[model samples]
Target: MIEAVRVSGLTKTYPARRGSAHVVAAKDVSFSLAEGESLGLVGESGSGKTTVARMLVGLAHPDSGTIVINGRTRERKDHGRSARLRRAKEVQMVFQDPYGSLDRRLSVETALRDVLRWHMPDPAKGTVRARIAELMDYVGLSEKHLGSRPHQLSGGQRQRVAIAKALAVDPAVLVLDEAVSALDVSVQAQILTLLNRIRAETGVSLVFVTHDLAVVGEVTGEILVMYKGEAVEHGATAEVLRRPRHPYTDMLLSSAPGPDWHPERVSELRAAFAGTR
Candidate 1:
């Protein structure tokens, strides 16, 4: 399989106070994805999942690490603006907040047009409006919604726009941070279906970061469990969820609602896991 992304010994630290020790956000957190494949990074808050997403998209700089996207190695700081823009075009990010991710002032067409204008030259092979129409169509949005602002559409609609914008650049990898967490259950399912279709059609590799195991199960085949800024477990999604070897993975599984959910079982798992620590 062709490698889409490979991250080695990635770590990031933030200074908290002048006298106090620094806070570590990601510690030796490393993983990789293959072309046309999907992987899920699951953990609760402060698990450094978001930090990993930020690092992948170049939104945050890593203290120490190696990130190779597609085939090019990424520098921690030395890549110039043009190089960074090329990287950005290669790997795009779809943020969690639908409304917050998009500019409310711009209409749907304009929002997509703005991204196309950046990556594509003026008078691009196709007109900007024509490209915008294709993107909206691909994302299941009709041309009638072209003039609608984010507030005018439902949460799911706004999210579709975000996804379209990410696809605008034709990136090889897409880092989706809780992309469907804000939508209703039905809407979430629709979005997931759309994503699966997109992946199947475009062969775009995905790095899905979310706290919901069920959501992860639906979209990803492989799983990486993170805890306290470190990767605690990694394996096939079904195997990990069915027979979690790590305490953190087991704890996350036990806490989730399921057909066999028993109060005592979760407590026993928690107690056993705590004893190990």
Candidate 2:
């Protein structure tokens, strides 16, 4: 299978503030995604997964790394507006807050049409409308809702619109940084199911960055477990969840709420693992 995304030796650090040492967000992180494959980037709050996602979508520039998508190696710095727009077509990110990502003033139809026009440029008059309808349908939204703005929609509906807008560009890679974490449990399930169907139909590679292991299990086939800005484990999702090799991975899995979950044990593990890392 062809590779859709490849990241090598990615490292990013923030300068020290207030006389403290510099902060390292990701250190020598490397991973690959085949065409149509989904990989979960799982970690706690400060594990650098979000940093990696930001870099993948060109939102953050890495101190050192190489990122290649769909046979194109991205330049270290995007040179101009044209280059940035080209990168937008290669990789799109769906942020955690749907409301923050979208414009409250624009209707859903207008938002999608704008993206298509920007990336695709001067499609036939009826083509844009048809494409907008297709994108809305892909995200389980109907034509009636096209006139609604972000404030008029529920959290889940807004997120679906966000996904549709991201898909409008026909990006080779979709980076979802905690995309479903803000919704209710039932809503999260629906969004996850929608993502799986979208992947199946479009064959777009996915980098699902999330803290919830259960969430990743629904959408990804492989997993990369990160801890304290480092990749501690990488393997098949089922194997890693069932039989995690790293202590941090074990702690993460055990920390999940389940019939067998033990908070005391998780605390102990966290304390024990802190020294090892």
Candidate 3:
């Protein structure tokens, strides 16, 4: 299979605040996604997962290293017409919060229409509505939800709408940044099923960025574990989850509540640590 997205030694740094040192968001990160494959990027906050997501979707440029998509490497100066258009059409992102990512002012139909118009403009105008409906169906949404605004829909419905919008561009790569973290557990499962279905039906490569190991295990075949702005461990999802090689990865897995685990025990311990603060 052809590689859909490739990153080698990807690095990013932010300028320091008044009294702080420079912030390194990504450090020598390297990975590759095959066409139609789903890879999970797992880590805690400030682990560079979101930074990698942003760079993958062209929202941020790396300070050094390379990002190759569909055989073309993205350079800092490639923000020209052709590059921008290609990036928009071939790569897309689904953010963590559907409410924040979507426009409350626009109806679901209008939001979808705007994306289709921008990315798939060559389609006949008369066929756009049908295409929109098809996309809605693909994401398990219906026409009734189209007239509703983001605020009017349930969390799952709003996320489904967001997925539809991302698919509007017929993108080859989908960067999902904490795509289901805000939804209820059941809703998260539904969204995961929907995403898996979409991947199976459309053969689009997926980069799922999240802090949840269980969620990642459910959907992704490969896993990359990040820590301190770098990838500490990476391998098959099952392998990594079952036999983590890094200390950070082990800590994350250990922290999750297991079948025989007592949640209250940890809560009490944490509370005691706080010392009535």
Candidate 4:
């Protein structure tokens, strides 16, 4: 399979702050994303999943690693206005809070128009409108909804708009950092279904970062489980979920809600696991 994104020996460490020791956000994490493939990066809070997503989209710099997006190696010199815009074109990130990512003052149409105008060469009124219409269609929104602002839309609608904005640039990779975690279960399912359809239609690679194993199982083919900033297990999503190798992976799987879920069992396992780590 052709690689659309690759990260090798990825590591990042935040400096020590007042009365706090330095934190190693990620360490020697390496993974490759096949063209049009979805990879799930799963772990609990502080497992470095979000850090990886940030690094992939150039939001956070890696201390030591190479990130090749769309076959272009990201370098330290990839700074400044032009390179930043170029990077944005290669990869776009959909944040957890849909409202936070969008402009409250701008209508959905205006928000999408700004992105298309900034990214597209033509930027013509007619062309921009056509593209905005196309984007709304892609995200399952109607023309009437385009005139609504972020506050006017529901949680799911706002998320759809966010997804549309990310796709406006026609990015090679889309990093979803807890993108659907903020929605209700029904809304979550809708967003996941929408994501699956979008992936099928666009052929864009996806790096789905979330702590929920169940969520990843629905949308991702491959899974990478992280523990304490290290990848403890990586393989086909079904296989890993069926027969998790690492202890941390097993703990995570057992904690997920299921027919036989036991909250007390989860607590015991978590406590036991914490002692080992």
Candidate 5:
């Protein structure tokens, strides 16, 4: 399988308030995604999972390291129009909050059409409308939805629109930064199923970043366990979930709600978490 994204020695740092003080957001982080493969980045809050996602989609620049997308290395400064455009075409991001991500003022048609104009300008003007309708249908939306504003839609509908917008560019990699985290449990399940169906049909690599291990295990085959700006453990989803090597990872799994919650596990996990802190 061809690698869709390769990050080697990826690092990011922020200046602290004190002199010569700095906060490391990500350090020596490395991972890769194969075409059509889903990799879940699991970590607690401030674990740099979202930072990695931002870097992958070019929203945030790494302090040091290389981001090779589809075999081309992306430069931090001025990445040039050609490089920026290429990055935009190949990588797309789905934000955590669907309601917040959409522009309430714009109709679904306008939202999608604007992205099409920016990313896929070569399509004929007449065909663009047809393509918009087709995309809406692909994401389980109807013509009536095209005229509706984001406020008129439910959370699930809004998320579907976000997915449609990401698909508009036909990107090779979809970086989902807590994409379904805001939805209710039932809605989250539906969205996860939708994502799986889309991936199976379109063959797009999915980078699912989330704090919920159970959610990640449901959708992703591979897992990258991140803690304190670094990947503590990397392996298959089932293996890592079943037999977590890192203490932080074990704590996360044990703390995650399950059908039969164990008080002993919760106590153990809490103790582990306190120790880490």
Candidate 6:
């Protein structure tokens, strides 16, 4: 399989704050994403899920690790302009808070235009506008929204705009950090469906970071369970869901919200995950 993303021994630490000792946000973590495949990163809050996701997109620098995207390995030691551009093309991130990520001043069309203009200069105005319109359509938006700002749209619409912005970059992979968690359940489902369709159509690999296991089931084929800054278990999402090997994985699965959850599933999960470690 062609590897779109290969992460190994990834680690990050922050200096002591509030008289506390230095904190390790990620341990020697390792995972891989095949080209056109989606992987779920399931974990609790403070489990370093976002830390790992942020590192993939250069939001948070890793203390030590290898991040190879689309056959290009990013040298953490290098801070050159060409390297940054290469990494940007390899992966883009859709943050949890769509409203916060979008510029308050930029309208829907202008926001996309800025990215296209910066990335590809000398394009005729007609070309830029046509591409921007295409992007809006791809994300299920209409040209009527072209003049609207972030605050003017609904939560789901804003998120769709965020997706459009990410797609505008034409990245090979998308590192989504709780991209749909903030919206209502119906809206979340809509976003997930859109993402699955987008992946099928574009063949862009995805690293979906979220605490919700059921949501993981909805979108990913493989799953990695993280706890306390470490990846404790990983395998087929269905296998892990039906037979979690790590106690932490079992706990997360049992605690996850479901549309038809019953108390008995918890006992079943515990027994299935038990003694399998």
Best model per lDDT:
2
How far does residue 270 in candidate 1 sit from its true spot (Å)? Answer: 2.6
lDDT assessment of candidate 2: 0.92
Ranking by lDDT: 2, 4, 1, 5, 3, 6
lDDT of 2 by residue, 1-277 (tens): 9999999999999899997999899999999999899999999999999999999999899999899999899898577989989898899999899876799999998898888888778687799999999998889999999999999999999999999999998899999999999999999999999999888889899999999999988999999999878999999999999899999999999899999898999999999988886
Tens-digit lDDT track for model 6 on 91-205?
8889889876799999998899888876777986598888898899998999999999998999999999999888887899998889888999999999999999999899999
- The collision pairs in model 2 are none
Candidate 3 accuracy as TM-score: 0.92
Predicted candidate 3 versus true structure: per-residue lDDT over 43-134, tens digit per residue: 98998999999999899999999998899888789867778878977799998888766899999989988877776668876778998899
Better model by lDDT: candidate 3 vs candidate 5:
5
* Regions of model 5 farther than 4 Å from truth: 18-21, 79-82, 273-277
Worst 10 residues of 6 by lDDT: 268-277
- Tens digits of per-residue lDDT, candidate 1, 100-174, equal 669989998888887887777657566887888889999999999999999999989999999999999899999
Error of 6 at 101 (Å): 1.9
Could you tally the backbone clashes for each prediction?
Answer: 0, 0, 0, 0, 0, 0
Candidate 4 residue lDDT tens string, 200-224: 8888999999999999999999999
Tell me the tens digit of each residue's lDDT in model 5 across 1-277: 8998898999999888767777799999998988888999999899999998999988899989999888888877746777777887889999888765589899999999898888766886688898898888988889989999988999889999999998988899999989888899999999999999888899899999999887898899999999889999999999999898888888888778778779898898778777876
- TM-scores of all candidate predictions against the true structure: 0.95, 0.98, 0.92, 0.97, 0.94, 0.91
Better of 3 and 6 by TM-score: 3
**Each prediction's whole-model lDDT (CA):** 0.89, 0.92, 0.88, 0.91, 0.89, 0.87
- Judge candidate 1 against the unseen true structure and give its global Cα lDDT, from 0 to 1: 0.89
Clashing pairs in 6: none
Error of 1 at 30 (Å): 1.8
Top-TM-score candidate index:
2
Pitting candidate 1 against candidate 4, the one with the higher lDDT is 4
